[model samples]
Target: MLKHLKEKKDVGFFTSIAGLMNSCSVLDLDAFERTQKAEGLGVGSEGTAGEKNMHDADFTCALFRFLQLLCEGHNLEFQNYLRTQAGNTTTVNVVISTVDYLLRLQESIMDFYWHYSSKEVIDQPGKDNFCRAITVAKQVFNTLTEFIQGPCSLNQQALAHSRLWDAVGGFLFLFAHMQDKLSKNSSQLDLLKELLQLQQEMVIMMLSMLEGNVMNGTIGKQMVDTLVESASNVELILRFFDMFLKLKELTSSSSFQEIDSKNSGWITPKDFQKAMEQQKIYNPDEITFLMSCCEPNMDDLIDYREFTERFHNPAKDIGFNLAVLLTNLSEHMPNDPRLQRFLETASSVLNYFEQFLGRIEIMGEQKEIFADFHSK
Candidate 1:
């Protein structure tokens, strides 16, 4: 441990840390770990302004002093010569400790600043050191990771830090993304649509491990508080309620009233399957249904299999789609204070039939009947 501290090579650092970690002598690290577990302290968001320290400032100061004293005992021959050169070994010790603390502190600073800023926000305090922070943080993580995994390693301790960093980083990025959106001036429909659409894109990019992890806890009560305060200010329920009403009427009147123009809405399941065999180019009618649904990502719904199977939509899937749309639109509507304002305002009703979709599917030569919704 002493040899590595003297040379401070990557291998040496890890060897030293590993040795200490297994033996469990670090008092500050132990307390910090316990605090995180007991408090359920969430991963800090990337978008937050100015950092709250990752460790107690007082504790850190004490730990640094302890480390210096502990390392002072190692490499006596080098220390003696250094003391003679300095006229006092204690003065040399102060300089070395100061340099070591500064170096580690710089790494910590870099990590905090890096991911928060882009090329644009460099002048911003949180963003100014973005690139420098990233570079420094990466180096620290790499060095620390090696140290933690060394033959005398503290692998568990290191793993805990890594996990905490990722959780905090992930939540921060998510926050920064949302802050970018919410801080803008837009209508509720625009904001909700934007957030929903954003989720569709970002959520799928996450690894399954992230989803399975306790990362959910990272969205703390403060986030929920912000959502309630800012997002709830816009009311969209009446628009959605009216939309739902029109959609409820969208089904065939003959089916709804049991009086057909010799027509039934249900196509045979076979013909429906045939239409799905067609490529993603849409006929006009399919476009209209999606527009009416107000599905912002309707263009990207193919992964749901409903894109091709629209003609195959039994009442069951139709019901499911209705539910999803209705639920999505109606959510948070009740939470908005603007609901009363909307109710007091104008009456709106539109019978929507748009087939403006950019994509559609068709089953080849098989003779299959498609639902009327597929027919333009």
Candidate 2:
């Protein structure tokens, strides 16, 4: 049954189903707001205000779960087909509209956080509302992650067409705002964790687009510029930087472990090169540069542990130093989470600046702008 679904002829069938799903999933924001007011805030004395269901959580989740199954697989054939279908039948709108709705709903949930204080006990209805929001958001992000893991070219083109760059910016803003709100309460770890996961997934998706040849030209530069500017918020910048470092560490360690079959903490330079190459993260020159940073022993083996530690340590990173200098963040010690966030934000800002410089083909006006900033 799954095999037949992957066939070219069946693409139209799935595309039509997606289109219908999208049309039916259109959210009535006003009605949604009213429902939240009645159920979450107890705005009206009687329950008559939310008698009509504005959003069907069960139905929506079930529908998306069905689509999620079709998109999930070891291969991307069916997902690609559904995504590439022409005209109104394409699945891109379905994904984008769902994302738009989910982000807005989550924003409302964040607003709901203001109603109760950490010192005060949350009422039954408030508790239920918060739980409901988390469930729906998890479903949306889980389904969307599957939907996005497909051919980069098709996904990148759809990204531009759907104006996802704008959505990405909006999401970053919402994330930062939510983080600020949650920091006050500090009890909603579940929702905060989910947001963190979503942030990482969104960044990974954008990295996929940038890593692919699809976004390597002018449009790519523009998109990168937009993202860099959008991530200017300090909270968002720290989150992105922390996620980036964690991801890099995970991938690099996995690669290193694969090459160190003997479970030793050391490997030859040739093995190091092979492992790095397999990750597809670093270019040849970058790999060579990393290799140069390591001091091989007389046996000519690299200390993988020491090398990784040195790579992750931000003490000497220019961005980290600049951040410390600019923010005067001497109150917290090195291991403090507050100080860590400062370092992460600084590192990400530096990386974004470097990326902006490297991505532009012609120096032109952009170079002068960057140079002016540097000179200042």
Candidate 3:
């Protein structure tokens, strides 16, 4: 079956399904706020009210999107079947339990401390939201997990069905990266252990689902509806995971914190102030990473190899030679008052930048790159 599935079409379709649902989860402005009303997981969302609410809606809505693709539609038809079910206690249990496991992973990142920044958003809007959302989402996930493990009599058969099996497996892979996050002062060994156990259970569950389909009487509309319901929830599970690992830098190492401007990897707050001083305008890539919060990864922005290659290329560096031409302006501008005023302004900026860079060297071990919350 894997071989028969065309890489382009199958991966494309499923991944597109994943992407769209991801958007939906974070799209709704209101539904996301509802999560905050829940207990045990609401902190650090202080000033980000609007941004956080909108972000939550976009993320959860995407989860619902994934659910619809599996079950057919997201409207009354599919939801009704899921809400009905005389004995669906079992199936709901499975979904909730899976979510609980995922929550632990999300919490690890959300609750993590020791975060640093050159800009308010790591200098990246998307990455910042991903970090905050994962924390709240993880708590909700764990709530569902306990729902299943505790008093609920989960529909062992429904959860063990074919489609639900695969959906669950996919989420396991997505959230599994949490093990590699930077987790000092945070005791996450238990979370990591539980995640590995869940991975094993996911495999077992998938087999059970396939076997059930072979022996079952008729799969029925309820079974189909449940498949969609479970799949959608699985997306939520994955979102918490992806947001934690990719954006938040949840790994155990602070390697990203040490990126050097000379190497063009990380941008510190000091990096920003230096640029603001306009010191010889950074290597263009460095400037882009600094201003835009990394077109690539927020945590690790500059790629020295790419920076050096581009800097050395005459075609590319032509854009960077603005300073050199400006130097000529500086040389000839004293002859004319109008041009001289412009020159004065330009030179002031240039001088400030040069001084800023010198200060960084002068103040070694004396001050932090980012003030207030940061300490060297």
Candidate 4:
């Protein structure tokens, strides 16, 4: 059956298979055990003529192979089926558990510290293994986000699911652990940045879920506790701020003066706009939001030092601070080597804090903008 499915080139066939897989009932382990005992079958036993001679391992391999085929050339159909299933409670739960499994497996094989260690002996095969693990991690994360944002949009049940929160926590922890591993590698940095954006989207969906649940008074205390615990990890927060401060250093140097003629240690909105355009990374909405956060005057000038002071303090609108960091990482020029390095490092840091604030805001804690700032 696996070989037949793999050889088939028809899109409809793949779609049908995907739909069937999605709609299938969950595995009945009790029935399977009963059947095994009745048949007196060993792990390698050949079944009767009417029944297929397959063990659990064979079934697992075939299932994965079918999924691989669906993913490889029939992604649209696969995604369509997933979209259809996104709203189903059972399907959402299955996706969450599957993603968690993949993440845990990847984590087991890819040693965060060892992968980045200078003293570790890393050959070509080892590097390939790291690449493969990161790719799997990315796939799992992307799948989770799609379920949250697409099929499961505003799905309170899915959002409140402990497995979903646990998977996200695991993802964030892995990202934090692997930060230093991607430092000197630009390609890996790009991948990391993409992962961060996906993480941000997932957080946004989770927040929407929280809002709905809060209004309905159905938000689980355990979910809230998980979010708060994940958000308040001090080491992660410090690491995030450390990269943020480093990225700020780039703006203080004389290089940016070439772009900002006023050079009054500040850049006006107009100037910032032009720089963003030159970099070909400008987004109007992001620029507007960033300008609002910095509180530019009639002259539209953004004072770097003042902006820094405002953004660095969590007490002053944690959401806005996150928006600033995200905007900076997204809009900064990647072609310029120095700026690219700074942006990549900033991206890694922003990744964690975005998740942090996203989780915290879900609990209704960090949404307000304060007039007075308290230094942390």
The best candidate in terms of lDDT: 2
**What TM-scores do the predictions have?**
0.20, 0.49, 0.24, 0.39
**What local lDDT score does residue 101 receive in model 3, on the 0 to 100 scale?**
34
Predictions: Cα RMSD each = 22.7, 16.6, 24.7, 18.2
- Which candidate order results from sorting by TM-score in descending order? 2, 4, 3, 1
Question: Model 1 over residues 81-154: C-alpha lDDT tens digits?
Answer: 22222322222322222233334444444344343235323223333223223332333333222222211112
Q: Write the per-residue lDDT of candidate 2 for residues 1-376, one digit (tens) a residue.
A: 5456444445556655555455433223345457666656666634532233224666667766776686776246555554554433333445555555655655566465544435344444454555555555556655665665543345445655665565566666756655444432324444545555555555544444433232125334544445456545544545433433442454357556677777788889888778778776655765664665556789999777765654344312323333323222221122334444444546554553343232222232223211111211
RMSD of 1: 22.7
- Cα lDDT, all candidates: 0.30, 0.50, 0.33, 0.43
- Between candidates 1 and 3, the one scoring higher on TM-score is 3
For residues 1-376, write the lDDT of model 4, one tens digit per residue. Answer: 4335334533454455445434322222334334456555554534431132112323333443444444443244353443334333333233444444554544443353343456323333334434444444444444444444322323345445546666556655655544434432434544444444444444444443333232213333443344345653424533444533433444554555686666677777676556544543334653443444454657766676665553344322333343443333223222334433333544644543554443222222244321211112
lDDT of 2 at 177: 59
Best by TM-score: 2
Candidates 1 and 4 compared by TM-score, better number: 4
